[model samples]
Structure formats: structure tokens, C-alpha cells
Target: MNGQPQWQPISMLPVFTDMIDGMLESSLEQLQNMQAVKDKPHVLDDSILGRVIALYSEQLQNHGAFQEQFNRWKKTGLCATDLAEVERLIQQLAKLKTANETILGIAKSISHATIDKIMAMDDAELAVAFLSGKLKRPI
Candidate 1:
């Protein structure tokens, strides 16, 4: 089998763009939340939330560049070099896959501790913390 990836069709470009757009938006939203809270311990704890957020932010910036390339590809259709770049981006996202899973696993591990806290939290408080990103993963 060839080690390189096959070229993607022009039709798939929009789909890829949409997927990346969603991810970028989510990352940006999370970053905003993280920034709003001044006292939250985001990076110091063993919690991987900070790392995950940073990863997402990096991905978002990458996606912005990719978006420009995508728009160009849309106008011109996919070329060999464009396909290669897309494949590279896919690989980068694949690496990010592991980090995303780690974040989920960490959250799951701490969910039990958070359950009581979450349960005790009022809707308004929870919403504020969640929106502002003040909510740290409960250890």
C-alpha cells in the first residue's frame, strides 16, 4: 500500500470547512470562557483542561489559515498541492484526537467528585461559571 493519502474530491471541501469551522467556534467560545474568570486555576492543577483548551486554541488558529486555503480551493477546485495540505491538516487533527480524548477521560475521572458540586450548584451559578469558564474540573 502507498504511504501517502489519496486526493480528496472537490465536493468534500465544504464538508471539511464546515467541520473545521464548528471546531474553531467551539474552541474560541471555550477560550473566551476561560478568560472571563480571573481567579480560576486553569493551568496550575493536574487537570488537563488548560492543556486541552490550549490545544483547541492552537487548532483554531491553524483552522483559520486552513480556512483561507479552503476558500482558495473552493474558487479553483482541489489541486495536488491542496490535497496534500488537506491531508496534512487531517493528520494534525488526528494528533489532536488523542488530546481531546485525554480531556474527556480526565473529566470522566473527576465526574464523581464534581457530581456533588454540580448537584449543589444553582442553575444561575452553574451557568455563570460555565459561560465565563470559571468552572474548573473538580478534583
Candidate 2:
């Protein structure tokens, strides 16, 4: 199989799980941090906000790389054990992708909302409602 992709044991990479978990964790922390300052009408820190955005961008690139690797390996064929592991990893990756998209969507929605709009929300309303489908943006 000349010119074909090689099938290395990629699922064994130490950073595989950590990278995914870290991205998810970072998103949650950022969202929580946003909530903490939800009432502040004029506080937008580019440096702090950029950190989570950068992390999400990196996670997305990593996910794409892993997907490309998995697709290439599909042609090479894994052993029974490796196949099972890869299948499990693929499932986990799918979940992670969904989570990444969800977080990105939240960030995107919040980006459009002005500080005055966010500050107008009552404490009973979730800070994330400005971004989530649960609450509609007022006209």
C-alpha cells in the first residue's frame, strides 16, 4: 500500500482525552466567569475574552486533525482491539464536537448582545439566556 496513509495507535496519545476535556472545561469556566460579571454593563476585557476564543479555535483545529487521522486510518484497517478503542474514541469525539458547537454558539450569541441588553436582564434570568435558545432577544 504505497502512498496510502499509515495507521498509528493514535488513541493512545496522552493528550487525546485531556485536550478534549480541557476545552470543555475551559468553556464552562468562561461561561461561569461571564455570569459572575453579568451585571457589569461596561466591562469587556479583550484579553480575557480572547483566551477562551483562542482555546476554542485550537480545540476545533485539533478535532479536525483527529478526524482527518481517523478517516485516513479507516482505509488502513485496525486490529480488533484497536478497532474497538477507535470506535469508542470516535463516539467520544462526536460528543465533544457537539459540545464545542454548543459552546461556540453560546459565545456567538452573546457577542451580538450589547452590555446594556445584558445588564437589563433580571437576576432570576440566567445570564446565559442572552445566548441560549431558552430566551428570545427582546425587540
Task: Specify the highest-lDDT model's number.
Answer: 2
lDDT of each: 0.52, 0.58
Model 1 / residue 34 / CA error / Å? 9.4
Give me the runs in candidate 1 sitting further than 4 Å from their true place: 1-9, 24-78, 115-139
Report per-prediction Cα RMSD to one decimal: 11.8, 8.5
* Backbone collisions counted per model: 0, 0
Best by TM-score: 2
For model 2, the superposed segments whose C-alpha errors exceed 4 Å read 1-44, 112-139
Q: Can you write out model 2's per-residue Cα lDDT over 1-139, one digit (the tens) per residue?
A: 1244344465554465565556556666666666654444235444445565566666666776677666665556677766665566676677767666665555555553445545666866655675565444443
The CA root-mean-square deviation of candidate 2, after full C-alpha superposition on the true structure, stands at 8.5
